[model samples]
Target chain A: MSGAGEGPGHGLGGRPTTGARTRSIAEAAWAAAGRDGERNGHGRTRLQWLMARFGRGTVIGIPYIWLLLFFLLPFLIVLKISFAEFRIGLPPYTPLLEWIEGGYLQIKLAFGNFLFLLDDPLYVVAYLNSLKVALVSTLIALLIGYPMAYAIARASPTWRAVYLLLVILPFWTSFLIRVYAWIGILKNNGLINNALISLGLIDSPLPLLNTEVSLYIGIVYSYLPFMVLPLYATLEKMDIALIEAAADLGCRPFKAFLTVTLPLSMPGIVAGSMLVFIPAVGEFVIPDLLGGAGTLMIGKVLWSEFFNNRDWPVASAVAIAMLIFLVIPIVVFQYYQHKHAERAEES
Target chain B: MTDTLVQGTHSASSRPEGSRPGAVLRRAEARPIIEIQDVVKTFGDFVAVDQVSLTIREGELFALLGGSGCGKTTLLRMLAGFERPTAGRILIGGQDMTQVPPYDRPVNMMFQSYALFPHMSVEANVAFGLRQDSLPKAEIRDRVRQMLDLVQLGPFAKRKPHHLSGGQRQRVALARSLAKHPKVLLLDEPLAALDKKLREQTQLELVGIQERVGTTFVVVTHDQEEAMTMADRVAIMDSGRIIQVDTPHALYEYPNTRYVAEFFGTVNMFQGQLIEDEPDHILIRSDALANPVYVGHGISARGGATVWVALRPEKLAISRVQPDSPHNWDQGIVEDIVYLGGISTYHIRLDSGALARVTTQNLERMAEPDITWDDRVFVSWRHDNTVVVTG
Candidate 1:
């Protein structure tokens, strides 16, 4: 039993919370303090609570296990597959590198596949061609998409919703079918040529089919929405009174657009460019279906190595090289995303 | 300009406040700059501006006062040439600007939202107008620097608009609008974005800036206090019509109608039948009140003709005994008493169930108010304190 001094009237000594309940309240305070770093809380907490909750089964252990099972496991498999030996005469055999006899290791692990790829210049050409196409397509898409996005932003509310729906509807349709439709349109005797000839605008069918131009058309068609959506999102968020303010400040409409509207839309432009460029670089369906055998891209080479030559090890090396090459942009994009989060919080 | 009539004569559309002795003294010898004719704007079915005609004199700060849904903003937009009037004309320096677009108009506006270009630095926002005129790059830079220095934003010249405070942004917008040196500058609720304290300070600063710049500033605002505190002339609007255009003192002291009196400020009004019409005063018998009221303004009030008598809360005096008052007398029970620091207001419940609000000065605090809640007392005002109004 406690005395009257332990009651709430006597402050901490008198109150139940100050006395026995003090310890429980402290525990509750600690519990309430954090949620992110915590495992059970899971969504959000601080480092201390996370550390406190972390036992032998927690802290680094669970995360390590999850990371190993999901992320590192796939990479390990790819690494092993990449180094395993394969030959035309020998059954594709595999081995791990270890310093067994001499000071040097790697008895079966081969660097010959990468060496052959470097010596052959065709692989280099393919990589360069893929980069060129993706870059060109991204530029074209941005040029077309920005105005379209701006129009959507400036349109009335009903039209904005309708336009946005139309822009994204292409994504819902079969992507392969869209590419095939472009193929039909770009063919030598297809609808575009037929229409021009019928109108006598062109003397005859222009050579549009199976060229770099056709490949470009297909890529831009597929990725235009990707560019537009981000631009639209950014444009929509811009305040309209700012434009009026610029005009009030004596700026003409065009000048207001150049200084206020255009610069404000840069983040959207960059985001759209990244979205279009990343996928277009890896695209196989468009070039293969539209350009045929003339389009020598990394995807085609990768397919050839794995299928036509049955060179599994070489294909794996090419895959690993492509992944390494891609890491630069991915890391940049991730950094941008992190910064955007910080901006969101600050605003 | 020397060539334009704007610098010599006030436009014919403006209400003549020439007789007020202080109006001439307050103007400091500048003339009218902007002349707006019977300008009317109709958007489909809704009439946005209804034959609104007014002239803003050179170097004078004029305010268009109204609540939202009233046509003050539409009238301002017409002056800016952002909106085209369906009927009538706008003359800036005697040049017809009815169809001219906003960019080509000599008048510049400061938007209520500040509308600072988010992408541009403070200098760039101010430079935009100069650049449009195709000024040399060096000249543009020099002018931008001068404008920024005027607003005390020289240290923040390179900083983007989002970095500035609301008041700072307002100044930037103001500087930018003034940078072009238009014949007239228009403002649309310019200080609406700031907090009450900031808004008041900015209002005074804006009026001071108007004086220094010597450009006709025509502002549109919903706040009567904003209109009263900032503008040399206040135009009260209601339902797409200009009700009264006068100096702030004139508007409060002598209103033309019941609506004008009530809209421009708080008014205690009683709908009455005209009982007597003397040379300098009007007498009206109201159904809601027990006594007839004598208003100072002479009105053509015939017997049985309905009219209104308006007395501001501050104009009404409350006491235990009649204080030799002449306008009207009433016995009321003090219903609600609110102490508002600087002043206290009393809601006196009359026998007719109507409430008379009386604001007494807190000049002496030696004792509590002589009357308490539910205490029956006399409320009265002098003839000069009341005005005759017709809806």
Candidate 2:
């Protein structure tokens, strides 16, 4: 069956009918058919042969299959569960479809779970709070990371390596451990409060822990390296002569930075902002540990619905809603990113 | 013969500065617009520039010619106020600019890489300097248009730097640097990045623009031909010091040392002790020459002192038969011949094992030359064509 597809590929590749070339082509076709046969039935080898006519199709199809199995399949299952009714059973959810006696099918979808979210103000507040936290933390990370990246990029080659290592040094430790370490520094009786008290800057310990400030500090600290690395990659590639040319044309140092350095590093800024903002919106650890009980975020609400309340259907609905909410911004961001990339390539 | 040599040196030394090429003196005397006074720059234990002083007249195109790491760039940077000299003062238009920052200094530079802002359009890049000065919007727009037209990049004004070709980007950079109308314009290897044909064309354009603007221009370049083509006066620099500064013609004709002579063009050196120092001529006897070589130039060196007589390759004439001249002539066998279309250079191996190069113009086109490999020929130069250096 594979031999049928090889006829056209042989002509297209213009491969000589040497023993080695023929053997390699045969092996590739066999391997592709073997993989396809495992998924579809073995009797469908002729179909696989037709699909494999263009050898490049098989190579391109591998990544599509991987994405389907790993990402789309799991997502569809969660989406299916979101429409099922919650029940105390082995699977803990009612079947979405049932066959009636008279050859008719009845589909039972528990859209009440989705309606319950709109009815309850808690979920809406949690989503709003998540977006606010994510936006604020990303801004803080950008503000701190930009200068460090610029300084590292402008540093001499030997010193540049040292500074870059320092930026990545926090990653050497486990991420949870790094987050936990921040707790000690931000607590009411932590080193910062103790030092401030000793310096007479404060009479007593401030409410430093279990607050939005602490949560922001933790999020910014963890995601700073992500911001700095990308910004440095862009800033390091920038020509320093651009700044000199600006200065030579009567621009002051700071104005030169705003005009030349800042605009040129926009790609890095966008990348770094997305890197910090995306994961931060759904981040559970930092807010769970550092945020006050009053602080509302969707990740915490989803966690409570699944583990504490044991409402699998509602939890899945909440998760689907959160994904939909996140998808809007992500799609918009990706559209702009694609447009920017095309513009850059054209220029 | 020695008297003529002394008279040549005296007349050359007394040649008025106003008579030099590209010299524009308002009065009989030239006024120095830019003064680099005993400038010394050191970089962390390395002396990048030794104590150097130079006076650039108004509207003169000057060139600092040197190889890599020769301090020419350091000197140019100092003039641009990018690097502050560790020891000396820089004065422009009679105002001390030693302590002034680059932004405040009335000078601008065109970088060698043509660093046009990639994000900005050609017109915006040209307007950048004017915007920095907080100029009025209408005036900035007018200046940008005028400058872009000056570089003939008006059509490309709306295009980003990456969209423009290399030569167009260079012109945009030139427009941007000149938009501010700086008192002194420093060009760092302005034509270095251009291709051969474009570079030759741009060289003339650069000279024309400089003359039209009448800005005191200082260009730093390692290419001798580039310096010779564009500059009125060329400063030959080596290591961390200036070896000699003179007009291009003078530097080529009367190089003061072996370094300057060899640096400017190809030269054959005959090292010998000075045998006689008569009023009209001097004689140098070297093993490279079968007989003593006569140079119609008397140096300040005493007789018996070691000196070198440098002869340009083009100055030496090769003949199939021995010449009647007794001095400044040698017989050698042609070891190699390089034909370069209009001129052919012959490498001759003399009895003393010294290889001398003689270049002659091909006046008539022939498939075969009169002289070929292994042909014994006489190489001779007129005495007045030779330069004698005692250092």
Q: For model 2, state the Cα shift of residue A148 in Å.
A: 1.3
Candidate 2, residues A236-289, lDDT tens digits: the string is 999988888888888899999998999889888988988888888888888888
Model 2 DockQ, alpha carbons vs. true complex: 0.66
- Output DockQ, candidate 1: 0.41
- Report how far off residue A293 is in candidate 1 (Å): 2.6
Q: Which candidate is the best by lDDT?
A: 2
For candidate 1, state the interface root-mean-square deviation in angstroms to 1 decimal.
Answer: 2.1
lDDT (CA) for every model shown?
0.79, 0.85
Separate DockQ for every predicted complex:
0.41, 0.66
Q: Stretches of candidate 1 above 4 Å error? A: A1-76, A88-93, A97-109, A197-205, A334-347, B1-20, B24-31, B136-138, B278-281, B322-327
What TM-score do all the candidates reach, one by one?
0.84, 0.88
